[model samples]
Target: MNIIIDTVVKEYDNVTIDIDGYVPIDIKLVDSKGNPPLYWRVGDGSKSLLELAVLPENGFLSAITLVMMDANSIHKVGNNQVELSCEESGLPIVNLDLWKDSANNDFSQRFIDNFNCDMQVYISEDTILIKIIESDNVNWIHCGGGFYLGLNEEKNITHLLINSLTQVDITNFTESVC
Candidate 1:
């Protein structure tokens, strides 16, 4: 693919987006073994895994989240003179789930700025659509709020945008959780 997360970050070793409830979501763009700290956390300072709390903010959300992580695992978004000068590459999509109170779930609805594949191609020409790879968890459902006895298959939080669309399935991830 011609995309990997975004553009400014032209290279990376690996990329992993950890979506957990406690932290909500933590995007780690591991560029080098000891690239240096670009964010903050309570841990050692060996320097890998850039954690961008909020830079590529997205106002859109849906049952599925769209991101392009290529073989290089490096991607950048935006071309604005001002925006291009930013340090962070991307942020949690619709991650406004926090610092704004919680009670809803959302996913891809519109082309979100700052946090999508290079808009120049994906949204502009509308060519080379991003593909959903296997075993890549890409969905999150808040399921109204409150609590539950256990994570039912329906709300086990095990969903992915398969076939390029948001769909639920009974996978090992769900089975182990429930």
Candidate 2:
């Protein structure tokens, strides 16, 4: 569903994070409040979570790595809070909607905490590109969406987009989902 903020159409195709390897996708998000976009990546749309990122409106941010746990379920609470939990624990692994009044986030911590390895961060085309180095030869990684991982076979590196693309709100998922 395309979110509308201040009567301005906010769609995913407007801002796309085109990386070198994987195919860029226009992220679909639901921003309840007038806040920024919230990206959730669940592995195969199953229980395992690959990443959960909150791009802080692309402004000032701290370099702190906030270690977050993987969650299975995510939902909005009272239109002001987001609770993510695993195994129906009734407790959220990480509760969002609390960072609204806080400072901006670099999202480096969420990468490290999710992958459990050291990663590089880069910002280009108004999106955060996370560089993860793996020794194994891998290709075609899909957790959130389709990814053509072998962008460079020699490098064997994967760069995941950490932010959402903004476009004019047009596509409606209520009738036919993309």
Candidate 3:
């Protein structure tokens, strides 16, 4: 993943903190009014502490880490929404805005907590890039997709454009998925 170090200051106090180049992702936090508060920021890329603490033996985020590239998209239930229609190819058209967040890493917990909808997590596997859809019960359902993780000409890590779920044949269910 590409690491671009950036700093953010608290909205109220302006206390700045350095976020070591985390990728920003757009997500919608659902509010009490059944509306999703749309916003963007660097997400917690590591496996959740809750997952680690609860399920020590399980690799809960292993599959997630695979499919979701650095610059991916997430949506929640709000205003000034950007429209991205999926083509017949079953892949969303590449839109850069959807991949970036407004505040970098200094995301607000209140904004997220106000939304009832769970955050969406995407992970690309060796071959299968899947969206880890969290169910009402917090169980995950794999929505398959594909993306490329590689180094660019400058030796900088970049996410190359790979196919999406519909384009990739993830049905093989074999070790050679990648």
Candidate 4:
């Protein structure tokens, strides 16, 4: 099994990470020691977890919301991209860009330029995970006079974890998010 981890730093404390291969079996939000954060409960990936007012650490704001994808649900669109869709409606929820360029990949950079947050990736023999860290410094643009959640930032944050039961699970198990 092989694993690869990538990190990206963007403006306004926004970050996005793209993990290739592997599939996830479970997801959770834990502290630096891997213990569950106080007053936080795991939820299905249908809504925003940040709205619950999960407090910040030190002076920075952060949240971990997991999107569990059945391994059979992912389809490769190209050599550098994968698409995950809603099983019931077949609507796309996330598009992973894995484009590899010279020296640097444009996928993470493009996400940073677009979202402006810090991102981390965790890949193991059987799981590919993405962690997005956002801070209060981010400038969110509210559209239609606050009719929407706001733009210029990736809100309703969710981490896409591939289910390990899929045929593609091959990496050695590794514990992330501690």
Which has the greatest lDDT?
2
Q: Best candidate, TM-score-wise?
A: 4
lDDT of 1: 0.22
For model 1 the local lDDT of residue 74 reads: 22
lDDT of 2: 0.28
Name the better of 3 and 4 by lDDT. Answer: 4
Candidate numbers sorted by TM-score from highest down = 4, 2, 1, 3
Candidate 2, residues 87-167, lDDT tens digits: the string is: 111101123333443445544323322333444333333333334444344332222222112112442224443433222
lDDT string for model 1 (75-136, tens) is 22232111111232222132332323222222321122223222211111111122222223
| CA-lDDT, candidates in order | 0.22, 0.28, 0.22, 0.26
Worst 10 residues of 2 by lDDT: 82-91
**Cα lDDT of model 3 by residue, 1-178, tens digit:** 2221121111121111111123122111111132222221223443220010001121111111121222223221222121222212211111122224522434342121111212232333322222222222211111123232222233222222223322123222222211
Candidate 1 has its poorest 10 consecutive residues by lDDT at 143-152
TM-score of each: 0.20, 0.21, 0.18, 0.24
